[model samples]
Every structure is written in C-alpha cells, then in structure tokens.
Target chain A: MADPRAEILRQAAQLFAQKGYVESSLNELAAAMNYSKGAIYNYFSSKQEIYDAIIIFTLTGLYETAAKAVSEADPPVERLRQFMMAHARFLADNYDCFVTMLVGFSGMANSGLKDDALALRDAHEGLLRRILQAGVADGSFREVSAAMTGRAVLSLLSWMVRWFKPGGGKSAEEVAQEYHDLLVRGLLA
Target chain B: MADPRAEILRQAAQLFAQKGYVESSLNELAAAMNYSKGAIYNYFSSKQEIYDAIIIFTLTGLYETAAKAVSEADPPVERLRQFMMAHARFLADNYDCFVTMLVGFSGMANSGLKDDALALRDAHEGLLRRILQAGVADGSFREVSAAMTGRAVLSLLSWMVRWFKPGGGKSAEEVAQEYHDLLVRGLLA
Candidate 1:
C-alpha cells in the first residue's frame, strides 16, 4: 500500500459514512481493513482520532483542490465555475470522505478538530466569496451580495454530497455544469 | 403534550437528531419526554419504529405543506417560490424532526417506511418539476430542463437544514427568499 495510514482513513471513512462515528467500531473497521484490530490502533488510537483525521483530511484537501482550481482558472466567473467543478470532482473521487465531511459529522463530539474542519469549510466559503467579489469588480458578474451568493453557491455545491452518486445518472462534473449554468447565468451582468 | 404519541416522536426526533438512529436510545428519549423507559416502549416498540414514524411523519407533512402552498399560489413561478418558502416554514416549525428527516435517517435499516419516505421526497421533487414545467408552458419561465431545474431548486432548499437556524442572523424564510431570488432570476427568460 502506498500509504497504509491513508488507507485506514479511507476505509474508515466509508464505514463512518455508511454507519456513523458513534455507531462504527474499529473491530468492524479492522474487518473491512483486513488488518488486525490492533493494526488500526497502530495508525490511530481511537475512532475519534480517525474521524478527526477525516474532517481534517477531507476539508483541507477539498479546500486545497478547490483553491488550486480557482487559481489556475482565469477571471472570476470561470474561477467560480472551477471552484464548483473542483468540489464536485473531489467529492466524486472521495465519496465516503465527502459524505463524512458534509453530513455525517454534525453530531460528532466537538473538539479542536471539529473547529478546524469548520474553519476549513469557512475558508472554502471565503474563496467563493472572493471569486464573486472579483467577478463583480471586473464587471463579469452582476452586482450582488458576495456573502449571500457565496452561501447559495456553496449550498448548491455542498448539497451534492447528499444526492450526487457515482453513476447515479450524471457524472459529478456534468451535474456541476448544470448548476454552473444556472448560477453563472443568474450572476452574469 | 399535544398528542402523547406525537410528543414521543418529537422528543425522539431531538434525541435522534442530537445523536443518531443507531446511537439514540429510547431510554434517553423517555427521559427527554419525562416518561419512563417502559412508557416509551408502550408508544414505539423499537428505535427503528420511532425512526420509521419520523420518516413518515416528517416527509408526508413536508410534502403536503409544499403541495398546499403551491396549489394555493397563483402562477407557476410563484408556486415554485411558495413551495420553497413553505418547506422552510415547515422545517423551522419542526426543527428536530426536519433535522432527523433531512440528514439523520441515512444508513438506517431499509424497509417500507424508507421507501415511503423516498416516495414522498420524490413526490416533492415531482411537484417542483411540475411547477417548472408549468412555468415553461405558460412562458413564465425560460425553456429549461424542468428536471435539472427542479433538482437545483431542491438542492438549494434542502441544504438549508444543514445551515439555517432560527435567529441565526437570517430566518429560514429570508434565506429561502434569497435562494428564491437567485433561482427565479436564473430561470427568467
């Protein structure tokens, strides 16, 4: 395995998403992992740690992927689209982690990790707002409250985790394009 | 208590939302209800039963509320907006059950109840798609794929469960209006 630790998190994420943090057990995770029950403990001490890792890894990775896509793209409108598409692509690639990050973690025991995860989520929101602000400043998008627009766009994109499934008809990118069409058309000056 | 059975469901919904389906306990629920553990069992045989009741009660209520608002509204566009606003009101009026309905029931044991819930959810989607279709038919909305537009609108509204809170800056109605503004403007020909 390229990264046994990462593998544990990946396997655990599916377990966590399918069940939940409170319902999941390392014994079950170990069975899923094909590792000794203690082997998981070697990588992470508790399920909470693994969940913390998921929140951190998923949100941090999600933000990085989206930010990179936004930065590589041109003016704000395309960047906004890029941000949504990138988020879709990331969630599609890491379905379990995205599910855990978005819906499965709410009742989780709050800690610095949960705070960190929320901060990363907020940072991603900030990125979208900045893109909207840039779009309006550059006369690409209509004048609107970037904060509210950011929340709306994030809602459309984030809600995908709940509904978008691989081969659930449309690819994540395809769905993202439809959302992008609606959003961009809505925002175009 | 308004209705003892409903009171049980309401208390159970908060417990389910705060913990989760598998993690929640009828004992805890009874404590929340100020009823004995045996009293809870008298109302619902199992946690699964409580969850089933929640799925049935919440989705059926939500769909009916939306359908009534849509039927009572004027044009298709207004109907669509009313559907969303009615949903927000329902969710706000029934916070715990909405939370349980929206995010907490996944991964629960599938049964006729889940199928019923999904059908109700699809019925709601059908209502939205029909509105978009009506809007397009009447030239009140642009020629858009009603299916995709319905999905987008549902995404925008459903995700509110995750973020919208009473007195959390914007009321759910206000947030729905903002989303409605984005959506209606987007679909305007």
Candidate 2:
C-alpha cells in the first residue's frame, strides 16, 4: 500500500483542485479519505501544511521535469520545444496537481507558502528565458526581448490547465507539436 | 455619485479580486463598502448573485471590447493584431475585473452562473478563432489549426493579468505590442 501520508496528500490535492482551497475543508478531506479527523491530524498538522507540502512537491516536480527536458545537447530551438512538450505532458499527467496549484497560487494570501510559490514560478520562467536568450545569442532566433517572449510562451503553455481535456480532443503530444511549430517557426531568424 | 448598485459591484470586484470568491463574504463586502448588511441585501440577494453579476458584466464588457476592436475593415492579419492589442488593453485597463472574472470562473462550480460563464468564454474564444481562420483563408497567415492557435493566443493574452504590474516595468502598450509582434509574426505566411 502507498504510504498513508502520500495518500493523504493525493486526496487533499484532488479536493483542493475540485474545490478551491478556501472552500475545501479538512473534515471533508478526511471523509473523502475515509479517515477520521484525528487520523488526518497525525499526518498533517493543519490544512495549510497539506497545501504547503503539495505546492512544494508539485513545483519541485515541475521544475525538475522542465530542467531535465532541456538539459540535452540539442540546438536551442529543439531544446525549447522539448521543454514545452515536457511541460504540457507533466501538466496532463498531473492534472489535479496543476489545477490545485493554479487555484492555490491565485487565491492564497497572507500564507507563508506564497513567497515560495512565487519564487518557484520565477525560477521556472527564468529557465525558459535562459533558453530564449541562448537561442538569440546563437543567431538561431530573432532579436526578441527574452523576458517578454518567455512569458508569452509560458503563458500559452500554462493556460492549458484551464482548457485541456485529456480524452476529449487532441492528445497532449499533438497539442505540444502544434504549439512548437507555431512558436518556434515564429522565432527563427 | 455612482449608482449605489454599481458602487456595490465595484467594491465587490475589488474584494473578489484580492480574495478568492470562496474566501470573501457578503458581510466583509458590505463592511468594505461601509454599508450595513441590510443595505447590501437591497442591491444583491446573496454573495453568489454579486459574483454572477460581476462575471456577467466583465465577460460582456470583454466580448464587446474585442468585437469592437476587430469590426473595422482591416485586412485579416491587421484585424487579428488589432484584436489582440484590444484584448490586452482591456485587461490592463480593467485589471481588477479581469482578475475577479478569472478567479470566479475557475473556482465556480455547481453555481447557477457556470453555464453562462462558460458560454461567455466560448463566445470570446470564438471571436479570436474567427479572426485566425480569416487570416489563414486570406493567406495572410500560414496554414495552421485555427482553433488551437486561437486558444494559444488567447492564453498568452489572458495570462498577462497574472503578472502585469501597471508601473513596474513595461507599459500596457509595450506588452500589447510585444505580444502582437511575437504572435503575428509567427502567424504570417
């Protein structure tokens, strides 16, 4: 069996994603898990702690996945394309986690986790900006502002969480390929 | 003085934007507006009604703005560029309403307004998709999946609400122009 702690986090993420974090209750989460409230407390001190753990875990996973996607020796454009595909794939695979993070980041205030979440986001954007800068420096891409372009592309990719339905339409791979074609060709010098 | 109803909505939008709709309360909204709960009830029946009104108002405002932005008889590519800039400017100008709508749409479920909200979003996306299709048909843009490209462009523009700070760095015009250049150039044949 999976660790009970892991199960708690997983269930909490689902609840948070389905309902906004503020709307989700520890009692409801415990009910969903078929655990007593006391049992839940044995694992997590509070709802905020569960939320923080989920944010930290998901952001770390996302960053590591994106970083590895671009670490290969491919050219800048290819590296960037791979990075985006990896990102879309990760989001599709962990749809609940992505939704939870999106809701949490947008709605959370006066929480210690906000700074960590923002820092993680900045670092993620930083990774994409570096690739854009590399593409420009290598004369493979046009002279666009890396910061703006990076944000635009990341925005295009991240918004998938709002609309992407796993089985309803195009597969994640196809969507990624289409995005790569549309964006990379636009950037080619 | 502004209409008391409009005043209530404006204050509610600010609170909703700052705090998630689920986290915000009618009593807090009334308190913020310096109105008693009874006075607020005269304008809105409940918290959800205020949210629905804001969603309807903002979405209607957004759709009207985008529709007007592209109604001129420019070439399809020019129309598309104009459409994007108009969308970005609207978001920048009505930043709080945009944020409120975003949080409201994402977190709203089992609410009476969900279908209305979804219909409005589809209509908004429909406007952009039509422009993309026109550009493709006229050969002003490369062959591309119009639906996918439209979502991508909309995502890029909509996500701006998350990070755009009015006086922090780039002006709204600059951001709009940058997005136009990056996306339009990508779409050109």
Candidate 3:
C-alpha cells in the first residue's frame, strides 16, 4: 500500500467514479494526484490501464470479503447471511471504490479488459451461487434456479449503491438484513 | 413521432446510452441522423437540451405505465402484480430508452435537470409505495416499512435493465413472475 502504484489506483478510482472512465483523462488524474502526467506514466501508461487496475483491485477486495464471510460459517444458510452482510459491509466501508467498480463495468463494455472484468464478476457471484446450491442440496432451501436467484439477490445488494447513504435511516447491514430475510424465507421449504 | 424533433431525441438517446453523454458529440448525433449540425441545432439548442428531453420522455412513459397498471385492480396484491408486470413490459418494449434514461440520470447528476429528474423518480416510486401501504393497511401484506419495501421491490425490477435480455433463458415477464412470487410470498400475512 505504500507503493505509488496503489496510491495512483486509489486516486484514479475516485476520479473515474465521479467523472466516469470515458470522460476522465490522465491530466485530470495527474492533477488529482498532485503529480505530472509524466510521473503517472511511470506507473500507468494510459487511462484504460488505471481503470482496469482499479477494477481488478475492487473485484479482488470483493472476493476476499465474500470468502471471509463464508469461511466461518458451517451451514449454508449461515454462510448466505454472512455473505450478504459482508457484501454490505464492504460497500459501506469502501463506497467510492464499489461505485467506481459498478460505473466502470457498465461503461467499459467495449474495453479490452471486458473478459477479465466479467470473469472476476462471475467468480464473485459464484460465491453466492455456491451457497444457494449447497442450501438446496441439503434441504435447507427449496428447489430454485440458483443462477436466477443469485442474480436477484446480488441485484438487491448491488442496487444499494444507487440509493444507500452512510447516515441514512438504515445502516447497510440493516438493509442487507431485510433483504436476507426476504430471500432466505422465500427459499425455505 | 413523425416530427424531426422526435426523431432527434430517439437518435440522441441511443447515442448517449451507447457512447455516454460526456463522450458523445453533436457531430456524431448529426451523422447518425444524416443531418448537418446546423439542422440539428434547428431542432435543439444543445446536447443538454436533447438529453433532458429524453429523460423526461422516459420518465413520462414510466409514470403512464405505472398508472395504467393499478387503474383496474381493486386489491393491493393484484395491483402489485400488475405493477411489476407492467414495468417489465415497459422495459422489454422500450429497452434502449430505458437504458438511455438510466445512463443520462447517472451522468447528468450535476446538470440543471437534477431536481426535475428526482421529483419524477420519487413520484414513480410513490406509486409502488402507495400499493404497499394499502396492502399492509388491509392486512394483506405483513407489517413492514412501506418505503423500504417499495424501494426493495423497485430495485428488483429496475436492476433488470442490467441483465435482462430479450432472447435469454427467461423472458422479462417470466423473471418478473419469479420476483413477484418471492416478494408476495414474503409479504403475505
């Protein structure tokens, strides 16, 4: 984290999240970092590289959070609850980074990093899918399409970025708790 | 729909949705329409005007769809089902405009249209809120925060724009039905 590379990624992510990947320029990123565009080149050759790196960083963070959430739980239902809470906690803690990831993914459909980004996304969603699949197999949850249900639950979590505020009426965990009840109950036999 | 102005808004919306508002240019719009920049200017003063017009158009369509969904239904549950179906239908029927509207709202956060756009959005969410309120009042739905439940329902429906495809494994209405089942069951008293 002490390296200039991580520093550059952090600054550029906030810039891209606010102005968007397409609209942001190296000059703006450089200005935000208080460095010359030449100095930025020492780390990132172009805006796209920075954007891609930020996405990877964000996704890696999500994967780690989801992993930790489920690693401690022995039951599928417990794992599912932990996963949702972890996802919410991650967003609440790193709101700007999560926002950058969402905005970048939606905007960079034609980018060279599309496949890599999508693979990471699928892997993150896979974590949730595995929990659902395990629950259904063990008779903890009813028979339902894991793929569809996973997307629906993730949508409920991700859509919070659109409206969630730090000091709003409900904390991120509280909102996730409500979503968890609705989803878990619906899946229960 | 026959007027050149309507034609311009349609073309601009697609362009803005695809290339984004900040990166899209008047030249690209004119080229897409096969009209010179001057001709485009005759119909619209600036790209901002065209962008604002498209958001208004999309929101108006959403309001009308939500209104018609509840017009004939006497029960809150039926109205809620109709509301979800109508939303899916609207998105299926007008995917690009909806995408354009989503993109425009995100990008133009600092624009002069922010207040107007938010008012429209709140009114649209109000329709769903009223249905939830009525359902809870009559002991049809369980006691829950109408505002939070409405946001959750809308999130389930709105997030479809991110992943819903015409020829996908499930149609928009099918997805809506599954979502309806999960939600209605969760809310049933």
Candidate 4:
C-alpha cells in the first residue's frame, strides 16, 4: 500500500476537487478514505494543512522534474519540448490534484493557505523562467519577457487539466506532443 | 433603464460569478438589487429559471457573435483569428457571467440543467466546427478535427477569465492578439 500520509492527501485532494473546499468536510474526506475521524487527525491537523501539503508537494515535484528534464536534454528546444511533455505528464498522472490546484481549489484560497501556495508557485515559475531564459540565450526561443511568457506557457499547460479528458480521441502523450510542437516550432508555418 | 427582468438576470449572473451558484441565494440576489423577493419573482419563476435564462441569453449572444465574426473574415486563418478575438472579447467584457457559466456555477452534473447547458455549449462548438472545417478545406489550419480542436481552443481561451487582470501588463487586446498569433501562426521561431 502507498504511504498512509500520501494516501490521505490523495483522497483529500480528490474530494476537494469534486466539491469545493468549503463544501468538503473532514467527515466526507474520512468517509471516502474509509478512515475514522481520529485516523485523519492523526495524519493532518486540519483541512487547511492537508491543502497546503498537497500544494507544496505537487509544485515541488513538478518544478523538480522540469528542471531535471531540462538538464538531461542538450538543445534548448528539446529541453522545452521535454518540459512540456513532463508538465503534461504530471497533470495527466495526477489529474485530480492538478485540476483541483489549477482550477481554484477553495481550500487553497483560505487566508492561511494562500501564502505558502503562492510561494511554491513562484518557485515553479522560476524554474520555467530559467528554462526560457536559457532557450533565448541559445537562439531557440523568441524574444518575450520571461515573466509574461512563463505565465502564458504555464497557463496553457495548466489549463489542459480542466479540459483534457482521458479516454477521448488523443492520448495524453499525443496532445502533449502536439502542444510541444506548437511551443518549439510555433504556428507560423 | 435596463428592463427589470434583464437587470435581475444580470445581477444574478454577477453574484453567481462572484459567489458560486449554490452559495449565492435568491434572497441575496434580490437584496443586492434592492428589489423585494416578489419583485424578482415578478420577472422570473425561480432562481433556477433565472440561472437558465442567464446562460441562454449569454450563450445565444456569444454564439451569434462568433458565427458572424467567422462568416465575415477573409482567409481561413483570419476567420479563426476573428473567432478567437470575439470569444476573448466576450469573456473579458463579461467576466462575471463567463465565470459563472463556465466554472463556478455547478448545478449541471446530474441535474436537468445539464442538457440545456450542454446544448448551449454544443451550439458554440458547432460554430467553431464550421470555421475550422472551412480552414482545413482552404488549407489554412493544420488538419485537425473540428471537435477536438474546438475543445482545445475553448480550453485555451476560457482560462483567461481566471488569470487576466485589468490594467495588468498585457491588456485583453494584447493578450488576445498574442493568443491569436499562437493559435494560428504556431510557436516555432
């Protein structure tokens, strides 16, 4: 079995994604995981804590994998392509957490949770910015503010979580590959 | 003055956008407009009808505008460009209704509301399909299924409601233009 703490966060993220954070109660989360209230409390102090943990965990893994992909690839365009593939794979693999986080999981909006979430998101953006800056320096990327382009790229990749259905015509790999093409080659034809 | 009926729907959409459908109550909707409960009922039968009407009114206008935009443009790419421009403008112009209809208002899952809402969405997709089909026929858009491409395009454009802030570094026009360039021109250097 998966680690209990990870399992608890997974179930909480799934429930939170289905219902808004406020609407999802500790009771429902426990029920979904077949855990008693005490079992849940043993792992998490409160719901907000669970949300913060998921956000930090998700963002850290995403940025770390992206950085690793960039380091492993030689050319900047290939790195960019790999970055899109990695990001898309992360979302596709963790659809519930990805959708809940990107599409405004209410729990994360709690006043206490916001700062930590944003800080991690800022770190993720820094990773993407570094990749883009490197691409520009190497004559692979077009001239655009790393900040604006970062937001646009992140927004595009994150937006897929909300719409890309699993069993539809294209697999995640195919969609990511197409987007990767769009990113590296652009649409200019 | 705006028709009281239209005014009620408008205010409801705004509130629904701000606070979600379940969270925004009829009493608050009426109170927000300083109208008595009876006054709101005088315009619509119930909160649900108002919800239905709001979507119908918004989607109808949007579909009409999109159809018209695509019809008047010259080339296939230009037509797609026009559709994106109009779609983005509508979303930006009426951010509240856009959000309420798209993400925040969530009554549709198994409710009777789903069919009507789905139909409204399909109508808009039909418009996109025609434009994309024309583009493919004219050798402009890369050969992509109208159905899937339409989904991807809507997913891309719909995210603007969540991220774009007025008076931000990029105006809606600039952002729309950039997206248009991205969608049509491809991202290759």
Query: What tens-digit string does per-residue lDDT give for candidate 1 at A1-189?
Result: 889999999998899788767778899999887889887777888888888898889889889999888873487777877998998898899999878876666744565576777799889989888888887787777677888888888888888887778877899999888888887665212
Interface RMSD of 2: 4.4
Q: Which ten residues in a row have the lowest lDDT in candidate 3 chain B?
A: B180-189
Instruction: Indicate the TM-score of model 4.
Output: 0.89
Which numbered prediction scores highest in TM-score against the true structure?
1
The collision pairs in model 2 are none
Candidate 2 lDDT tens digits, B118-144: 798889888888888877777778888
User: Chain A of candidate 3 scores what in TM-score?
Assistant: 0.89
lDDT of each: 0.81, 0.81, 0.80, 0.74
- Candidate 3 residue lDDT tens string, A1-189: 379999998888778767767778899888887899999999888887787788877778887888887864488877888899999988887787777776657755657887877888889899989988888888877777788778888899888888897777889999999888776654212
C-alpha-based local distance difference test score of model 1: 0.81
lDDT of 2 by residue, A1-189 (tens): 469988888899999888778889999998988889999999889998888878877787888889988875887888888888888888887788888877667544656778887788788888988888888888888888888888887888778888897777787768888888888665222
TM-score (chain A only) for the predictions, listed in order = 0.92, 0.91, 0.89, 0.88
Candidates 1 and 3, the one with greater TM-score: 1
Error of 3 at B178 (Å): 1.3
Q: What DockQ does every candidate get?
A: 0.47, 0.47, 0.41, 0.46
Give TM per candidate. 0.93, 0.92, 0.92, 0.89
Model 1, position A108, has a per-residue lDDT of 49
The digit string of per-residue lDDT tens for model 1 on B1-189 reads: 667898888888888777766677777777777788887777788888888898889889988999888873488867877988998888888888878876666744565577777898899889888888888887877677888888888787777788788767888888888888877665223
